[model samples]
Target: MNKKVWLIYGMLALATSTWGSAFIAGKYAVLSFEPATVAFLRFFGAAILLFPIMWIMVKNHTKPTLKDYGLFAILGLTGIAIYNICFFLASKHAPVIKSSLFIASNPVLIVLLSGLFLKEKITKNNIIGMIIALTGVAFIITNGHLLTLFQLGFEPIDWILLGAVVSWALYSVVGKIVLKKYTSVESTTYAVAFGTLFLLPFALFETTWQDVQLATWDAWVAIAHMSVFVTVVSFIMYYQGIKEVGAAKASIFINVMPVSAVIMATVFLGESFTFAHGIGAVCVLTGVYVGTNTKKWTLFKRQNKLRVQTKDSA
Candidate 1:
């Protein structure tokens, strides 16, 4: 409503749109590079930018112990190495919109896992929302034929994207622990460094020096977009938004990511928007809303009632 809030919101929207654009970029990158190579190049470049920024911004940086290095390695393995490999592979085989939707549902999985592992509360609303979101994902995967899941199993690409989701959930869960010791920026920088290291061997296996030299200009541009916009710049803006607006409000902007991905994929990749996609989008967005916001809504209602009662007593 105020100028500052509006600016934060705008930045959040722009940051999320960059996330959406990653799907389009990944689709293009995989056309000219292997999934492993694409993943390696993107994060390797991101690390180059992230480390310097972390050094400059985090003045009270602490040296990590050996255990801290272990945690960073896990974060890298799950969030960076495994997640991006599956991400690019899914982009190669699945529509970018579908891939984006699958990734968007990550919060559902994160919530479920947090409840189980982190001893977080799992409200009735959380359960209901998860079911709805999963149903929507199923609809998208089956092309609105829910029963086909029994006769025809998930496509390999669906599983690959699901791996990406699961890996991200694990990353988030582990990140909670790491964040207790480090800032998000520090943890992320270390994770990217380790992930790039982990990816180097696989990338070398898939790509030769000749392949890297001969990569198309489009591929380089796609990788640069992911590295600079999605990883570095967008993340900085998103974090600033969290600082200004709080995480709950900041997270609501994530809905824009999938929508932007759909738009970009449609315009750039010439992908179709099917009826099934429409239905799934509605369900998924609705589910994410209910799951994430139910607690806040309930709290607000209770506070409003308390205020009204106090006024009546006066």
Candidate 2:
């Protein structure tokens, strides 16, 4: 509502849009590069871009212990390495909009997982949110006929994309451990470094000079967009968004990512938006709203206020 809030919201939109566009970019890049190469180059370039920032942030900080290094390695393996590889594969095989939608479900999955592993409360609203989201997921994967899931008509690629979502959610959930010791940026730097290291062997054996030479200028441009905007600049803005707005408010901004991805993919990649997609998208977005905005909604606040007054009187 205020100037600063407007600025932060704008930045959050920029960050989400950049990330969403990365899916479109990846679709272009993979035409010339192997999926592994795409994954490797992304974080390798991201590491190069982020190093100076990381250095500036951590230069005077205390050195990490061996245990810390171990945690960083694990985060790198799960979040950066595995997640990147799976994501690239998903992009290669699945529709961009579908992949983005699956990604949009991350918050819901994180909520479900948090309840199980982190001993976090799974509120009634959260359960309602998960059901709404999963129903949307079912609709999309089944092409608007939820029974299609029973028929096994969905593409293997769709399943692969969904698996990538799980991998990413696990990355977020588990990173809490490393986050305890380091700032998000610092943890990200170490994770990217280690992840790139893990990707190197596959990149070396799988990606050749011929592949690089065969890549088009447009493909390289796509990679640069992802490496610079999506990986580095977007993350910096996201962190700032978190600082400006609380994490809860900032977290809701991520719902924009899928919408942006769908728009970019439709415009650039010539993807079609169908009635089924519209219905499913609405469901998914509504589910996110219900889940993330539980405390922010007017009705929820009014109910809380009344409950407090009742308690006091009693």
lDDT of each: 0.92, 0.84
Best by lDDT: 1
**lDDT of candidate 2 vs native?**
0.84
Per-residue lDDT of candidate 2, residues 1-314 (tens digit): 78989999999988988889989988888888888788888888999988899888666665889988887888788788888887888788888888888778778878778778888777877778878887887777776888768777668787677677787777787777677777888888888999999999999998888888888998898888888999999999999899888788888889889999999889988988778888889889888788756666648768899999999999
- Candidate 2 residue pairs in clash (backbone atoms < 3 Å): none
Model 2 stretches with alpha carbons more than 4 Å out: 297-314
- The parts of candidate 1 lying over 4 Å away from their true place are 297-314
lDDT by residue (tens digit), candidate 1, 43-76: 9999999999999999999999999999999999
Report RMSD (Å) for each prediction in the order shown.
Answer: 3.3, 3.3
Q: Per-prediction TM-score, please? A: 0.94, 0.92
Residue 97 of model 1, lDDT score:
79
**Candidate 2 global TM-score:** 0.92
